[model samples]
Target: MAERSIIIIGAGMAGLSAGCYARMNGYKTRIFELHNLPGGLCTSWKRKGYTIDGCIHWLTGSSWGTLYRVYEELGAVQGRQMVDHEVFVRVESDGKTFIVYNDIDRLEQHMKELAPGDAGVIGEFCNALRVLAGREMPSDKPIELMGLVDKLRATKALSVLKAMHKYGRVSIQQFAARFTDPFMREVFPEAMANMPDLSISGLMMALAYGHGRNAGYPVGGSLEFSKAIERRYLGLGGEIRYKARVERVLVENNSAVGVRLADGTEHRADVVVSAADGRTTIFDMLGGRYVDDSIRRYYDKWPVYEGFLQVSLGVAHDFSAEPQSLAFRLDDPVQVGDQSRHWMQMRHFCYDPTMAPEGKSVVIATYAFTNPEYWNKLYADQEKYRAEKQALADAVIDRLDKRFPGFREKVEVVDVATPVTFERYTGNWKGSYMGWMATPATEGTWMKRTLPGLANFYMAGQWVFMGGGVPGAILSGRHAMQVICKKDGKKFRTSTP
Candidate 1:
């Protein structure tokens, strides 16, 4: 039988993962990417001899388990050094610091010492983390492929499910409100201010994963990790066309047949897989004719993760003794968009030597949940956009100088990427790096890959998967391939590097 042909949109983690699996299953595949380079949102760029990493603070499956196996197969983790941090985050308020240690016992003791009045809630929180530490993510196989025995084995996740049930409905804000200590209340919410409505279950699971060493930072950062997957796909005889932006998915009698490029070029394929932005794929590329009411409701009502403005500085000062991640309350509020931000979070790359010069470090401060519309409108006026970026960078530096004393003098390079920058580069909706915001209402929602009344076409990436991240995006691609293989009456197969 002749091999089927597939065209995958966006050469990010999902697209690359789909290509790898397609090739392994005897399918001829080609990927189309808008950017000249791969990795979409999972990317980095060099500025003044310093590499500013834009993504991947801690990969959930960096070390072990089924997700790790997937990474190993995709060559994302082959021979890569993974760094596990002892302190996940440091929260500071009024000159008092509270550390979130990777060790559950240590974290419990620290929290007790900081807020002895709220020791009960702290103990409960730490106990939940302990329970999740022993659990592992299930295999990557789709639900249709799971047998009776596999279904029975899934019972092992009962403890995790119970834990999630108890805390999944409570938001981080609500969790913080339970604390009696003034400092604890301020620190708890600030620690997770970026994800204010994020469920406590999500919080515990992240801490648990970090404590268990499953979540670790891959050395060399996002671009290198993506390059590994790109190499794997290329090695499997898959073809990729860079700077090829798809304008539309050609449909015949409600079945997808191919795609038309932006420059009036056309290519036909037996299958079309889109790992691009969800809104673009449905409303723009497919013309929004194939979606049902549920899909419409999701697109209309579901909250997308807010975009962020990242200010990266190449500092000559060494921050080897500082925590990798730190969040603190600002004495004076800084103007960001229309709001005044009283808290600031900065991530130090001192642990990774490859990011900076021998004695220097790359320090990044991200202002999350910034309104994309504000940046989008500001970008229309080129001079104003550039001016605002510079002003914001200056304000951030001035504030940092107060905290670090002489930080302004040590800064050799400053790079600022706004929400508009992400939209221009990766084509993400509203410049949202992560797709849907994982709130109490949308925590475990599983979006269907195949749209209603649409055939020979599928969707993958962060958009389809709630709580979008590297692991979920990669797994969504694998699942898309599995669904395609089932439709084609072929067994899905994967190969390791």
Candidate 2:
């Protein structure tokens, strides 16, 4: 093939990573983003002096683990200060509180204390953790003969392969089921319910081992992360075009030729990679000409996860009653059966004082999992949506009042983001925060890839390689680029500056 240019759609984490990888590998790369900025749902927003992080909770490791090595190579961690979370997270239920620590032994002890007579279950769980302790994850490098060989020779590769051989095909539920304690079963379901069965708790267990080594937060927030990746990409001679909405990936016979933007501007390239929505890329943009039955079924059948409602609050004073800090699950479990009221979580933030004015606190109140039908019916009524959002914010404040007692009075600023907000800003279908859920049925499947049958087209981000967090997207971007590099007979590289 002749010297080729690659065009990437969507400037989310995955797209940015793909761009970087492609540039590193000596391919001319350009990215088109519908939004002006990057980072998708993981990006931060500012409203009246409050900086709210929409989705970042706690990343697995800072710069100590295998994955952190990738970040270090991407130039995302050099000179970046991270604040390790002192307390992992707390779960409050039925008027009882369970504090989860970074130490595996301490976590096991807490579990045992919470549910007496469950020592056997705890030990078994620990054994399972040990089994997964040194496991490896599938690399972002393309999955081919050469890639496999390189991976085999890479550091920690044998341990990863061993773990994969041992536990890759099983579901998380199945792994949890190995222990027969009610508490164990309940805990696994609660923790892993949102996670796909195939997420490799073995990989997560290794992360757990590494988390205590160093679990730090970025001082600036997610935007800083996005900017760092973008900076590196630009430094490598890659181009990122904002407000560029790709309408279709132009194809000649069976190979991806180029892409046509929404404004009817066509740019020619040898290969086109879509880090955008699969449905948007294949069916809507490509006019459904290339889709096979398998791809059709994926878009038409698989359920997309629901969106979130986020309320960012800037308070007048610090709510530092709890020294260690923070809870994951809310005090009350969301009432799935009830539709009249919504479930919300209030996160206490004193992590970065810069997030708010001096002596003030920033609290993020978020609640998700609403019915699509209810939201769709109100599209024509803007005032109604605004009212509902206000009401939702009020409910969150009420919940915070229960938890923090005097939280309602100190509210300096309150800004709400709805599903509509996400759809409008990020162009994700149905405002889904994560793409397709990586359940047992769809784990490690192609739903993680770009919409199938679209020529020279691939996708990255939460949509690919089983949706999880920022790390999954970053890794997937590298994978997509690696796959493209293989097609073009190139080598993978990363920019350090």
* Highest-scoring model, TM-score: 1
* Each prediction's TM-score versus the true structure: 0.98, 0.86
Return the TM-score for candidate 2, rounded to 2 decimals. Answer: 0.86
Task: Give the number of the best model, judged by lDDT.
Answer: 1
Worst 10 residues of 2 by lDDT: 334-343
In candidate 2 the C-alpha lDDT for residue 355 amounts to 76
Which ranges in model 1 have alpha carbons more than 4 Å from their true place? Answer: none
C-alpha lDDT values of all predictions: 0.88, 0.68
Candidate 1 structure quality by residue, lDDT tens digits, 1-497: 98899999999999999999999999999999999988998988899889999999989988988999999989999889999999888988887998988899999999999999999999889998988896965657766677888777877987887787778888998898999998888788665545778888877878898998989998998999999999999999999999999999999998999999999999999999999999999999999998898899888988887667899999998988878899878998777866788888999888888899898999999887789999999999999988988888898899899888999999999999988888899899888988887778875666888989989999999998777888989998899999999888887788887
Model 2 off-target regions past 4 Å?
Answer: 1-3, 145-215, 321-344, 444-454
Instruction: Write candidate 2's Cα lDDT for 231-318 as tens digits.
Output: 8888888998999898878888877888888899999887787888666776777888876787777678765666666678888877
Collision pairs in model 2: 83-216, 83-217, 84-215, 136-160, 448-464
